[model samples]
Target: EDYRAKGFFKEALVNFVALLGWNAGDDREFYYLNELAEKFELERVNKAGAVFDIEKLNWLNAEHLRAKDPADLIEPLKAELNSAGIDFSGRSDEYLKSVIIAMRERVSFVKEYIEKSPYFFLPVAQYDETSKLKNWKPETGPQMLRLKEEFAKLGENPSKEEYEVALKLVATELNIGAGKLIHPLRLAVSGMPAGPGVYDILVILGKEETINRIEKAVSIL
Candidate 1:
């Protein structure tokens, strides 16, 4: 807003995407400062106020996140997580790699995964207070805890080999339906009632982080 009034649209446009709410990747991201005037298309621009729509921003973020290679996604996520005091280095890159896969559906931006899934880095400080009480039952916590314990024994990091075995065990023990278990588990770990596929979340967060989140949720209950 400051620079835009000064007739610096290019700098302001870049600034618009860099601050509190920024959409970093355009097909034009690769364009140099020298090419700004030629590449800049004013026709496609939307005129709007700064009353942020989370849904629209999140969808934009997901599109950008998906466009990035898994390996490439890690560096920026790592930088953000590090600034937030999360030790992504100690955790497996495989987990980080798969995390991109897990979160792309639910989150709109790189910052969002950190914001929404802070339990992956920090312990969850606040839960969805309304949903917490509305949805969580005493029995549900223990059921999830028991399943998480069993899930941990599968392997260090889940592979196709171990995942199949774990699914078989889940089918045998849980017996009722995977959705029943998955629903509660998703809520426990993410604090959202729904999200990207569960198996992938487990694969990315890894067994330890997944179990840690479950145990923390159970303790809170």
Candidate 2:
């Protein structure tokens, strides 16, 4: 932020990508780095930052993440984690897909998963119990149990509005504010205090995966 606060834009731009994700390889350096020598276009570089408007970046990152085969991103994601002594051993790419979906909101550069997210993605890693405790609650536990049953019935590609409607229903049944269901629900899915609206995450993850994560959350709680 300091270089950015100064007018060293090129340096700052180099630093900005470093702020969130990992560079996959030296083969491609155009988007935010070294490409200036041949491919740098002023139109491409913004003098001002978007300031982590995760909604915009989440959609963009998901587009990029989804466009690539799950295998491509998964191996890199696993390799990055393993180098740090994190584990993806024996965990299926299916779970990794859900982790990517869960974190799409919490990350900007997208590869932030390799660095910013270890607790949620890796196996048998130690984490801050206090942080996890911040979002888990007794009522939230039962709420998720019920949510699991509800979401378990959805099809492969349910819409966001479908999940929203289901959430509103869950809110009503629980006799609590949607904020209660949504906030805790989001925390449970992403293992973070904040993220994309919970409904959107559910929609992207599809129905079955959503239910599976909710079931996992209930068990953890």
Candidate 3:
């Protein structure tokens, strides 16, 4: 019951448990309840105790999690956020939907999805120190500052493509790799070294907030 409350999907659980003592005489590992029911046979059921494999369960859960529609996840996602003591107020439906889209492929559980990106809910107070030490350089601050200025010119609500184009243009102007700016910029906006595509995250965060974050990161350096 606690596991269910923690965001394990029912169909995924069913699919995993059914495979415990039964194999449908084939190489396939995934099947719906109806499909398993049609294939179940008393004689074919293994008499030995079946060991539970958590990896298999997680794999099944991942598939089910991805198959779900983002819209259907909103209420439960809000409930999870409330449980975590994160205020869901002021977040719009469109913003929440964008978050779901950003996170869908990144998490197997709803709770994991919400917990993995707290920056989505709150301002990134500080970046990951290791990422900063590894990725930041003398040129990083100035380049990001320039990138921030470029972003400012885009007006509000630029598409993800526009953000990428601006970043690459700045990198080209500077005659350095875009990665020099990108790595630090990611740390700035997300406080983590990796996440969904950088521009995708920027589009979701919007121009003003994104540029402010870049400026903040430049200040940090």
Output the number of the TM-score-best candidate.
Answer: 3
Provide the clash count, candidate 2: 0
lDDT of each: 0.62, 0.59, 0.85
Q: Candidate 3: worst 10 consecutive residues by lDDT? A: 1-10
RMSD (Å) per prediction: 7.3, 10.1, 1.6
Q: How close is candidate 2 to the true structure, as a TM-score?
A: 0.51
lDDT of 1 by residue, 1-221 (tens): 65333222243344335323323336433323445545455554545544554444444445555656778877767877876777776667766776666776666556667876765665557667666766677677767777776777876877644654665577478575655566667767777655666666666666777788888888886
127: Cα error in model 2, Å: 7.7
**In model 1, what lDDT does residue 126 have?**
64
Which segments of model 3 are wrong by more than 4 Å? none
TM-score, per-candidate, Cα-based: 0.60, 0.51, 0.93
Candidate 3 colliding pairs:
none
- Candidate 1: C-alpha lDDT: 0.62
lDDT for model 3 = 0.85
Instruction: Report the Cα lDDT for residue 209, model 2.
Output: 61
Over 49-147, each residue of candidate 2 has an lDDT whose tens digit, in order, gives 445543433443444444444455566667556756765675678777766766655554435775565545543233245645765677778887887
Residue-level lDDT tens digits of model 3 in 40-115: 8877778899999988888888788777789978877888888889887989877888898898889888887667
Model 2 residue pairs with clashes: none
